[model samples]
Target: MGQFKVIVVGAGPVGLVLAIALQKSGIDFVVVEQRKQVPPPTAFGIFLWPHILRIFHQLGLYEDMQSIGQVMTKLENRSSTGEHLEISNSFELLEFAHGYPTMLFDRRTFAEVLMKNLKRSDQLVKTNKKVTNITTRKDGVTVDFADGTSERGSIVVGADGVWSTVRDFMRERAPPGLFSEGPNPFIAPYQGLFFRVPRPESLKPGQTVYVHQPNKQLMALVTATEAHMTTYERVPDVSERTYFSPNKVTDEDVKYWFDVPVNEQITFKDLWDDKVMGGKVNHDEGVIPWWHWDRLVLVGDSVHKVECSMSPFRGAGARCGIEGVISLVNKLNRTLNSNPDPSRQDLSRAFTAYQVEREPAARLWVHVSRLDIDLYTSKAGPASKAATFADGRTIPIVANSPVLDILPFPDEKEGVVPWRRHPKADGQSKDVKARL
Candidate 1:
């Protein structure tokens, strides 16, 4: 069999997007995923920022998304007492940064769209193939799967989720078994119950309603085509003796929290009784550090995991995927263009560039995501009050430059162009009469 140019592990959003990008660049690659098929139950919703929307446009999916998802026009933060603390319309501010408006979409639908485009490229993705081991040689890397199958590639991209086998392989090359502890203060397992209930009449359309009871709990009603409600409360200890199971909270648990009479229509039992509805809520309290040795990288939740904060932005993960793909591809392109007979040193340099460019951004995002969680979940106190107030306001923290800025396009004189103007738009200008 011919040597594969690149092997991407995981068929999640990041891996799929990377595969499409590679295909567009005329690169030979394969995506291997452990799952037999795409997951169901519309895991959750994702808010796509402008940069992410630009990507969808590039893939000819922007219009398709607009047809399905809701365009989020405003973001409002309020206290439990119903006082509006802060309000901003991202459509007005972020439009200047990215050409498109921010969008909210169901995760399952987003994945389906990506898969629809990928269906045209048969053999681009292989499912039910789990990577068990990866070994780097003088020339390239060899990937061994759970089924005793092996494949070799010049490079392996670990788009796999947090527990990545590729990252594990590279970690083995580092100081033996180094692992970091959890970041957040240990809280009891947070049991969460999520349901796509009919749009509650009390909730306004196109708005996200959050109800927080000091020290008791937080419930967020996100308005989508349907109302997506999630109720979270911290459990003191998760021993077997607890009244509720972390694995799955029952309808009775929901009744106790809401303190509402169980009716045929209003009961949590009715809500999660469907096979698709209810499950145990696991406890997690940390953002795990993600780093690896030569020739391997991690992205998305595979790098950091945290509870959902009120940020209402899901494009961050997509942005990480885009950064990883561009960093690795640009390095590979540079090496191939510069060296006719590239040595190991050349490959190492490329890998170093990838790490240097992407690691800081990855770490910063982890910090920001964690901070958001801490503020939202803090118990009722002066600290919590301050956090609540701060949530509504956008402080100009960066006086000089924005905390996040898109990098400038590479110099054209250097024979590198990271972006190009639309040819149609360019040609349209030529049709105009010359000015006197």
Candidate 2:
């Protein structure tokens, strides 16, 4: 086994997923979370696209996820005036194309599934430890925490969210010209209010709805037990786009959106009255041009964010973050296989290759999601036209998703769109791999 270890900061879904992948590859690692507990409780629902579900299948966690989540199959689009505009089976088409359902569940349950499956989670995850500083050397990196403790490892992975302290450290410690991006890589294009309520008997399980208004848009996803709703309000072109600190919904703000119609049958107030949890936040949109420098690297929202509420196709933020994690771990495994203790240059090369393979896809999602938000806020086009994915860009992206190189990919019957085979998966031919 390699003597080097990785220190993962932030114990969100992205960080926990990294811990699992590292353990499966026999790599030594530890996860440090700033929060008092991992996966901090939340009422918001999380959506896992088919491509991400395939990775869960490879990890043997798909069944666990399926047990607690509902498969989303249909979406209904409505106008603020209570007109049923259209009903699209885009999710159904996606399932048929990729052979895996789009799963939706409470965010906390998803994190719990990842944490419970880790064989050494008690030892691998540390809570209530916040990173205060990061020190990198020729041989390794040392991370100092607020508790006056430190952990030394071969490298530091910043899985923290957008306002990342580790990212700040990278800017402070790097050579003057190493990074050209400004302090704020993301901008607040829209403001959002989200809440969840008990699922109404009238709504079907796994049904999602989108309501488009003049300058605002709303989406509601109904799971087995709860219905989570998010309303996006456009920030006027003349208004300043600044990040707003998260806070509870104020009476005035709630009153402004209260009478807004979510459907012909229900208004925002009807759901808000029975809300279990609710909050407000600004939707930041953008991807960093660079993801790594020397021994320190970034993952997840620390580098890229397409706020989940803004997109019609959800979970781009978490999905891209996890994709980056898997790519990073795969590259790390390949490097350590040849040399137990890879040099700084060796690690730098690996980080660079990871950014090359993953950044473009992330950037594309940022652009695609921005367009989605724009289309919704502007109320310009056929709302249901972009919903189908069987013949769109979603199909190609799902088909070409990456899997762990060291493990066999789980078998499933071929769908309309066959997955691009990996050379190392199921002993596929290099020619087939080249074609992919």
Best by lDDT: 2
User: Candidate 2 at 294: error in angstroms?
Assistant: 1.4
Model 2 per-residue lDDT tens digits across residues 50-138: 88888888878888999999999788887776778888787887888888988887888888999999987988899989898898888
Any runs in candidate 1 off by more than 4 Å, and if so which? 1-4, 39-41, 76-92, 177-193, 201-205, 215-224, 231-247, 252-256, 259-290, 306-310, 313-315, 339-344, 381-436
Per residue, candidate 1 scores C-alpha lDDT tens digits across 185-209 of: 2233455655555554444556654
Off by over 4 Å in 2: 180-183, 236-247, 308-312, 379-382, 386-391, 423-436
Candidate 2 collision pairs: none
**What shift in Å separates residue 378 of candidate 2 from its native position after superposition?**
1.7
lDDT of 1 at 127: 78
Instruction: Tell me, by TM-score, which candidate is best.
Output: 2
Cα deviation at 248, candidate 1, in Å, is 3.2
